[model samples]
Target: MRTRPSPRSRRHRRTRPRSAIRLTAGFLAAAALLVSACSSGNSTTSAGGRVEAALAELPRSTPSGLAPYYTQRLRWRDCGVPGFQCATMRAPLDYDRPDAGDVRLAVARKKATGKGKPLGSLLVNPGGPGGSAIGYLQQYAGVAYPAQVRARYDMVAVDPRGVARSEPVECLDGRQMDAYTQTDTTPDDAKERNALVAADRKFAESCGARSARLLRHVSTVEAARDMDILRAVLGDRRLNYVGASYGTFLGATYAGLFPARVGRMVLDGAMDPSLDARRLNLDQAAGFETAFRAFVKDCVRHSDCPLGGRGTTPAQAGDRLHAFFRKLDAHPIPADGRRLGEALATTGVIASMYDEGSWEQLREALTSAMKKKDGAGLLSLSDSYYERDADGGYSNLMMANAAVNCLDLPPAFSGPEDVQKALPAFEKASPVFGPGLAWATLNCTYWPVRATGEPHRIEAKGAAPIVVVGTVRDPATPYRWARSLAAQLSSARLLTYDGDGHTAYGRGSTCIDTAIDTYLLRGTPPPAGKRCS
Candidate 1:
């Protein structure tokens, strides 16, 4: 099993909190799969209206330096996925210096399938800062987004620079990554702490060695700028968008930077921009604990519950689970063709926390590991979180997760001592998974590149109305974050989903989906403070 950044993150606190601050835990494959299963894929209508919002920015009269990027026509060719086409976009490696070479970002789209006047391009991002928008487009959004929206608008996604096919960041080989993920994060002594620190250092050094030239340029600001270039290229005076999880942050950044160019936009599973690295990371730990309790409450309902029976309290359940982790810390169990240790086991557990639907699978996995000595179930869950294939190779998801996370903000802790000092508060915040997540926040501290951003509010003063969706019991991005983000964006309307999981839209809520679909097609956001259970 391996770890990640979420509130962006893994199944364990040791893996860093999944995706919010690290924001890796965002818009995960699970959510994509859910869309495939839960969505009707049929919004057949003769609706012709696409966003015609008044956007001030235009390509004409463009500055000579940036004109070439803005005016170039796309040469779309068939992507491997049928009905979808792919192309590459050229963005300056550094916006400050147009002459400083270029970065090629991968773009994919599925043209409007309906026979009405097309609405123009609707871009989608599944977060990660590191997550592949292109992949999400090809796999989920291009096909599974509301059919009416798909019918009128060209579904498009651009892999942010240093993510997926867009010159992805490379740091460690699968074997090296395996070791790094296995490193004991909740160090009991100085020696273990030193080992953890060394691993973080080595991981940072490897990234710098292999990807230094592109590292500093992959910040969210740059990616938002890239979206503007894409907006011009797509012939859209205003950009229409669907951004989930960390993607919410990206979309918000674009809105803040180019409020005039922003159009009908939806930010689901929103991340708050006003919090510092430590606060975000710590908030994520509490989020995981929140998800964990949700899982426990669900588990106790069934007879096969491993942690406890129907009347067992969540705290009692947490203690039992933590004890099991401690036992594995001493002697690992065997499963999944490998030994299941504390780190991997914890990661496996945390992976399911992203979605409550997986609580059943998690219960069975916990039972096999706790009672039967068969660890295959938990190991499978962890491997999926790491995106490990049967061949043992890994996708660049975790690597890019770290590269963007480390560069976006300073490390949550300057050193292990700071982590030590913060432990009590973290534990109080999240008794089940606090300590390791606090340690996981240390990864950015050793990054080779200094941070280019800090905690700040995003107030897109004159942008068109943008819809923000938040799930109250969401694990990765807490519900409050959505509230916070909506408050920050001057023209944003908040849509609350009193539910579970990482994101809200198209995850089996007609009220939630209808509000967003109307906004996307009709450019009418729901009333602010709208709540849907």
Candidate 2:
């Protein structure tokens, strides 16, 4: 959620309308287990044309200022998993000149504890670009994976640079963040809008001030290279990975840079590297609109829903919610000694937008806000997105999110004028989402970094079998990204999860799980373009 300058956000409606905004929302592990599974390890291919060619295409490493850094030998702590021990990996602050400063990536592993054979290490990244790989390790990967897969491989994860533990991207402090989060996103006039613009400028300034050195180096390409170094250090002949969401981008980039080194890989919730800035943002806005429609249809069925009632169509329900947002914009409700305004309310709604399991929670939050005028529950959800602490301190998620996003591509818009020009197209794609998202997409226009990456297809020609997963109704990474990515990668397979939610790996689809488990454990790729309900 990077902030952008808005001169129009300050416009107080001469007469306020009702509407609402919604909120929106990584990791691998390792352990040593030796097991004889149904599948056996494939012989590593010699570095030759395919893999070596890909590596040859990579840009020379830039100076990352990561010298003078030392890997901290973490006392392996058992995180309740029998074979898994967590440690931290340290690399030079700048990989180009390893003699410079260093950064620490929080790493964890479950040792292979099986008989007959071993498949080396399998690294997992739960997408966030900022998501805690270590957290994902302890909570899910350590236990839930199929025993066959678990037994044969050491599960490993390292939080990427500028992510959870690897020298996080620092930005605004708590109070400033609160103000930035609450800044009006919807504007009716020039004055209110300028305030929004100011907020974005301040956020960028804070990031530049606090994390200038690291900000320039947090691109997905760089992160992928880091994984290579980690792979080398781990002594794996080839890298095996399971990446979700942004992790998919990282994994794909890794394959593009070091194709010959790729072993078996799974990229869930794949992002289309082929889509340009405006298209990506517009498509995501439409994706949220799709998810919102699904939520509305579900909400109407529940008797307790606040926005759905007599004659309330899903479209109307959406309208009412939007109306609520407008009302909140002018007169925010008080909650927890803070103002619970449209920005926070929208964030809360968007947070629940990721998973249908949270629909009931969203309903309750909306009801409380509508009926009692209390917005604490909703505010808390938004806070979770911002990774804000109770004391108002903020994590570096927003900062890193902005840095990576800005560097990945050019700004979607130059300013409000640019957005206004694109508004009709966006609104047509998603009447419920167009305006705000169009404006939101403009944040990169104010970014300090000149975008370096573009939306180009990453073929990673001749890479080993890679599986690309898509959740049909995912708000952040739409299903089409999977299709596009699969088409882009020469050896990619598209595994479709025709369901709701952000990513589809362990979200209870037998089809998704079985196919992926088989690939991870048995090296049998899911048939290309396979559909799962």
Candidate 3:
């Protein structure tokens, strides 16, 4: 379970280097001479053949209205990585025109350790759609993955275009983001409801005005194409990948397009690519409800539980949180010179809802907020989700999150009116979160670009065996997504962890870890729907 701090502010930072492909005006002249020299001997196939073939099949057609690519040098510099240097790659701002404007993509890698032989580069994406893969790799994956998995492959990470290290999409600055985090999402009246709608609209507008050029291009389809380019430059015949959370959607996209070139893939916390936005949000709402019930069950046994009383029941936990949300809306608390309202409190607590590790912190934060009228702890947790820094600058998480989400599928609701219409179904799915999250569904209603795509099933027929891991009580990527993805893929093996969290592999399920490790190291898939306690 990933535990983040409250919403504050932070700025984006470029973290990695692209492969050694230089896109310059001197390309055609130098390419002819180099090709002649390289092909002089056998004149047929070599490692370079893999590179040529990979690039030949890429989509040359970019979207019609996309901005032209603007060429950039990407100042290459050292990033304190040992035996690994950092640089950047520039690709077309739009894939249609290779000679147009370009955008910088940040890439990173720790070279394969074994010198005897190297299989190839293995790319890893920790699924946020907005989550910084480089940061996730540096912080955990690079060091923690099994040695057998690490020894034969070079571990690589790329912040997808419009994401963290890649020319990130910008929205509100830290202070403005602070206001967004505090905006009331759940309303008790028409006035409060209108306010919520306004806040969401403002957020959409901010992203549009600031990241207009990149917003439409941040779709999962485009990101998968970018990965293909990276694969070409890395000199790999096939793509080896491990994706979690939203990354599952990305990996699946790659498989959908290039199943023939697929290698070992592990999708943890998989998203159901077939679900429409409304269904996705509603399912996630229910997932959170499931996780909260688990927490409430645990809280009932704790002596310090503030919400449970002699008359309280496990079922009442949802109502108790709902009541507290109402109270905070009526009167917000002050925390560290910031106002903590129901929206922030709810977002904060929900942010912690992803992983069981943070449940204790959530309990403490909720107790303080409910009993002492202090909202600082909850605020901190929400800030972490938003990737806000202490000084009040904002990272590009929220910006990229909305950008990718908006492009991947049509908005869940057309407007507040549509959201209201869907409320009944959402509430039926999740009494605790349905109403507010249904409204949250309206966040992308005012997206700058019309959605170019819609949710559809991905049947990656020719792809190699892929492992799909799911947690029964995952809040963000529900367990059903894992089931759905496995069903979609021809060779998918489902590994179910009867646990709580956003993802299952590394969050302390022996059964989950052992199964995944065996798959990655030995190329053996766990049985379909294999359940772990």
RMSD (Cα, Å) for all candidates, in order, is 9.1, 9.7, 10.7
lDDT of each: 0.77, 0.69, 0.67
lDDT of 2: 0.69
- Clash count of each predicted structure: 27, 78, 23
**Compared with the true structure, what per-residue lDDT tens digits does model 2 show for residues 58-113?**
53343344312322234677756666687667666655556656666777898878
For each candidate in turn, the TM-score is 0.90, 0.85, 0.85
Candidate 3, residues 1-533, lDDT tens digits: the string is 01111111111112111011000000000011111111111111323232111111223343443322222233446668654445576666655555556777888876778644676878988765567777766655676666666787888888888978899989788777777667666666799778777877787788889888887677777787678767766778788898877777788778866777788888887877666666677777687788888778777777778769545665687888889988887888987688788777877777666666677888899899899988899888766666677899877766776777777666767777787788898788778767767776666677777765554556666679988888788776778888977887777888888877667766667788889877766678898668998
Mark the 10 consecutive residues where model 2 has the least summed lDDT.
25-34
Order by TM-score, highest first: 1, 2, 3
**Candidate with best TM-score:** 1
User: Tens-digit lDDT track for model 1 on 377-436?
Assistant: 998988877777888898788878877766665566778898899999889878888887
lDDT of residue 533 for candidate 1 = 78
Give the number of colliding residue pairs in candidate 2. Answer: 78
